[model samples]
Target: MVADREGGARRKPARAVAVYVAGGAVLLTGCASMPDNGDLRGVESTPRQDTQVRVFAMPPREDAQPSEIVQGFLEALTSDDPQYATAKQYLTGQAAKTWRPELSTMVLADGPATEADPAGVREDSVNFSFTLTGAKVAVVDAEQSYAPAQGSYSRQVRLVRDRKSGQWRINGLPQGVVMGKSDFQRNYTSVNKYYFASNSAVGTASQTAAVADPVYVRRRVDPMTQMVRSLLNGPTSWLGPVVRSSFPSGTALRKGAGPLTPDDQNKLTVPLNGKATQVGRAKCNEMAAQLLFTLQGLTPAVDEVEVQAGGEQLCELDEDGAAAVAARGSAKHPEFLYFIDGEHRLVRIPPGGSRSTNADAVPGELGGGERALRSAAVSRDEHTGAGVALDGKTLYVGSLVSGSSLGEPVVRSAGKTEDERLTTPSWDARGDLWVADRDPEHPRLLVLREGKGEPMEVQVPGLDGQIRSVRVAADGVRIALVVENDDKQSLLVGRIERTTKDVPGGKPGPGSGVSVFELRPAAPALEEVTTMSWAGDGRLVVVGREEGGVQQMKYVQVDGSTPEGPAPDALTGVKEIAAAEDGRLPLVAYSEDGIVRLPDGAQWQTVVKDGSAPVYPG
Candidate 1:
């Protein structure tokens, strides 16, 4: 317990961790940080659990003891003080000038523990020292990228008595800030930085698909300005190989620009430096589109974005113009959720609707029930459909239009039985089809460019297990796979690298060999993953079971972290599940209850009495 400014006792929250002072009983409890402004609002309130209460940092008391000064400085680091000005007051002149808290954040498992240095305890000593220690859980870099880390953390902090004032101040410490896990959560919010897929264009098409790259930024800081700067800096390292930035090589916001905010008409004007002034009109528009899509998630949403350089407007883009350039995220909304009905035929229904009978049979051969189907996929435009035979021996490509005919099997599996054959087919944003052949004799991942030509075997380096299922993201760069080995299945997200290297056997392959490598575990805790689908820009809806546990459905991010939202309601006997990239759409699944849908804020509703595989257009 600590005394309040009014001489009352302040109780700590249940989960609060304590930072001990070096020579006294003073304890600093963890708290959520906010921006120091009257206009601050609850966008995504931190886990501090005091949403209605604001805690202001108390400055150092007059002639304070060294222990109190150390305790106050640590508490101020977790407060909502703007630029941490109050915290700086605890540091000496040279120490305040050298501290760079924005460079990085060191997240600990609990509040740091402080111990007095034996050498600084003498009465004649003018300088006192202490050791701050904790167990590090992760680190957030200057680029705002969060990566898991593990190790012991120890730093020496030194304080000296001011000669003129006879007051103690922190004179030596590390550059970055340190806090507990809960404090870190309250201080940052996740935001997606939009980028264009490097391979979205096919044939002569010019438009590209937008990919979402999520990052964490300090919510109370200058978020609008920080976000624009991150976008200009480009994508994270894991996603950098497959995506490209529309901004010129060295483009950046003009130096010393004020905080970025939309005008009364909901227009955001981005003034770039001279490096971006020479771009053509078409390229400039693409840059503006990226900005609009990236900023659509924040509060006070802007309706239009203008790009300016060298004091002149280069281009402008609204929602409509952004959609025409890069199709994805809020710019595009899916029409329906698809599934294989009781008759093992392809069917469709309005996403988030209750109708069932009127949703069967899409069109042409796929809807005609000419051949028994085990799984199916529809292209983004809902113009093409790919179906895998019930026996899993062949994959057929057909048009989703009336009076259209199904062509010969696009690809066939040589597996001896249904248990080892082609997996569900998937379509990419660039109009390509992907499938995996699980034949024990020759397992391979295959891709069909433009849904035609010879089947190309995709190279997957460093894979030690058999591929059971595959789902391609809307971005056309990241692919999710459920690989099984030694009776255990793992959910892995890998980068799609289109390379010039030859096939695995040193033989020339068609359409420039593409490899899926650098795979990272998306659900490292789950013992087995039954099925999954891309649910958002950087999130996936997964169904799996842990060791000695019942099956569960949850959303996992591409970077192996749990998201902020609640998990979908639990369901039993779920064999296959599907979710649209648009979060507004309902989640469809094929469970023991047959085809079912989970509408927003409602329990599961039956869509039909029988169905197996459910999916949304890629």
Candidate 2:
């Protein structure tokens, strides 16, 4: 820290250690030199008449003596008056003019020095160390205002010098000045004074000589940052319940704006291109439903609320909450868990089953049926608990759990898990199943392949928040997912391409690798589209109301390469769509006074004329 002279401000230069630890001992020893002695009166000086004479002309004899002329120069300049009268006798012209004024306030203390090749004559040189006290001016040009007044003072100074003249003189010594001028100068001025006073108190108050250590500095971390970092660190059993209560169904990317309600059924409409025509009517089976919810994996709770119509309670929902919740079935008491009644509800039923007023109502979990999913397997019996993914030949059930830092998913073969724990599931192109269990402690992505008992796990690096969406690209070269970034609305992409496991303190896990892509498509506009489906070709189809105000269908090709902006019309204007195979167009279904098909004249028969909504690929 240095102080300014004019402004009476102090400036602190952020000092960092550049010394290499490898050869520290040797380097320190080599740099050591004797302190500058103030005895300049006895030293030899540069010859007055021989000043212009070249040394080459004189034959060298023994070693030349230290210059008293140089020594006198130091003593004279360091004096309050600079001994200007005597200095004028040795220096003339420019040299005399520069030091005369500066020397008045320039104060010098003892400095270190070391003579090298003292016995040698040619180009003999000595290194010296010096300490400066009082105030020094520093020039700064930082973005902010400069600090520290010029006239302020400090006692700390450390610098070195290489002197060829045996006599010590400010003119002959290598010198460097530390000062402040601009933004840095202004800020540093206050900072220096503040910290200097701070360090002084600490030095005087504490028993230990160390002024400020990590113990004191560590207190500066903001409380919010620390809390966020903790959750980011891993799953905590103590926090599990709290996290669950806040996010009952975890966090889910829903299709609509309203809270997921019992009547809300997110359907997948497949658009059959080519020559598909509007069919009149055909017998239809009830549609299957899929629900996904996410919480930070902290807390879980169930509460009750009065069911109201225009702010009037038609009836009090069972103690659990709502009486007829879609996922929970017809329960005597329903808590409306996961907002299955309030919002984010996806429910569908077979054609004939819709006749019952409460066919898809929430079921009672009080009879030891539904329980909290807290194990690594994430098993839940209630409809509000977990989800199951079904491909052509197999079904994979999954649920998010919070007992451990590591999320390890359990997979049961199609007919195996009548009473087994479920896990997070996905399907690959070859009809193979993939499961991922998130571990908060270890923070990893666990992948389980079908028929293979032992699963593969890979460590995912610094995930700042709960994982949102995970998808494997068509090329199998990347695993894409949305994770919360610093800003809540935006997401950051984390990619891991290494084929080898790079787990710290352990072997690397298996993975195509992880990489985060920055793009997020706008959610399906539910009013315009009732359902959304991702085609094998990477296209997305939304089924619902299209342009013209009539129920219609449309699709958009995502291909993972779409630039981010307003959602393309082709993607959001669909009523329903389905993907059959690559190169084969997905079938589109909609109802406008009657089931209608775009592109006209292919499959004419319709499933149901007055059906509430059509379910594709159920």
Candidate 3:
């Protein structure tokens, strides 16, 4: 899918309608002018406004039976309540106190089926089990990490009658709630909480890089509180190594602090415990920034955030300040598309060009190198470039600016022939470069840290196919891979894991090794995916053929759902495609006509005539 960006209004071409005429042509004869009816009166109509307020779902009745209570409790889990108060009514006092609804969530494709086993019931208690058989789109864990899930889920619940009230209440059950796809859609909304990049220099003028952590919260349930709480929980395991949260180790919301609500002026006040009171002013500002960026997605955007500790305001930040920080960390893409010309000279096309134009060669030795270049990638900081030589055996890294010369080949293919050579290079937000050597004799995916040292092999378990392409997310946690096996192409998303250890001087250094884990199939409905790019957090733009045998471009959620939006026009004979982490940048692709770009609300425009590979900084 194309990134969402602002553009000029699209002018649709006027269409002509075909009118059918009977044998002799209905409009063959001309008629005289008719007089106006001055006495006719026109009636005025007013639109009816809807004034009915929606009633919230209620808790189970006091006298509800055990079976009815279980059913009601499951249904109540889908309600838009900040605390699931209604759902707790069906649980025993002790059980309710110990239950953690946020521990995990099971998202099933269809409603679950329950069956009661009276034979297992005791004198005052009954037992029941629910059988859910359907596709599991995804699962969210206690850390609010979303992972693609599949297969069936089953669990049991036990209930006993309350001695005084004589109402059935749950005594035992699982920690998290289970809901069907429809209820999940109605009650849960996917949102991203921002965290600063761990390697970002503090107090520096450089833009602070923000990583997006996507999670689902109850719809209409105090999203401001939900987002802040999730942010405090810290980044997920996959992201923890790459991003850092502002909240201190022991910091937490003040006791008795209920759901947070904004005032009429769009100002929100957050109360923290004593752990936050010891933090300095700059740290307090960082904490407020986390809240401001997370709350920007609310229906009525929050304008300002005030953080307090010990009943005293510690720091406050407005939307403008928070926006500046976010913008500063954002990736600044280059103003041109660079590629190898016919003479193997690195050339570039200026941004927003209507057609291909001759521009100066890329600065430095790369532009004048003797080795023919096949593909290349620019770094997110736009300070370096990685290129694959035309022979497909050598990988070169060099400065993007004018004065510096290209370095020696950093990686070489181990394949016996040209077919098993290096693929296109890709960069991650952490400044790591990734590429796959498709040598059949020694197939492996390698990562080069800042283009230094020997490329390390990344373990990809259960991958029996030939690696075709690799694209890493800007967050440096997830990777998109296109693999071909048995003449079929599969698009998979995997989580990257890195282990760090303390070095001699107590500095943290790379641990044993890096590996990719929990590989899951995405865009499963597509038959043959040829290319893909990370369009946004937890979202991808894929080019593939559907079951009907038609090639198309569409957006697919990481959970295997196709997002609702207009698909970009299909490009025939497209060689490659690239997108920036920021959704506001346009999409560029290397097609038969040259380097073509799809600007917001605009059709494809050729930016360079002879370019083969077009890319933006990761």
Q: Kindly indicate the candidate among 1 and 2 with the higher TM-score.
A: 1
Q: Which candidate is the best by lDDT?
A: 1
TM-score sort, best first: 1, 3, 2
Please provide, for model 2 over 1-618, each residue's C-alpha lDDT reduced to its tens digit, 9 standing for 90 to 100: 112222211221111112122321101011112112332111111111211121111111122222322323332332112124444433323344553332112211111112222232233334332333333332112211121123543322111122442332233232222222221111111110000001111111221110000000001112112222222222222112111111112222222312212322321221111121222111000001001111100112212222222222223222222111111111112111121111212222232211222213222321111322211111112221223322111222332222212122243333243222222333322112344333333333445432133445545655555443344322222233434334232122222233445466434354534333323332222223344444332334444453346543444323212211233223323333333212233233433422322222244334334322222211
- Arrange candidates by lDDT, descending: 1, 3, 2
TM values, all candidates: 0.83, 0.23, 0.75
Query: Could you give candidate 1's per-residue lDDT for residues 118-229 as a string of tens digits?
Result: 5444444568877777677677777777766678998888888888788889999998787766667666667888898885652235568788888877766667788899
- Please give the distance, in angstroms, between residue 576's alpha carbon in candidate 3 and its true position after superposition: 2.3
Top-TM-score candidate index:
1
Per-model CA lDDT versus the true structure:
0.78, 0.25, 0.68
Candidate 3 structure quality by residue, lDDT tens digits, 526-579:
768877888876678888886778777777766565554588777887767776
Q: For model 1, which pairs clash?
A: none
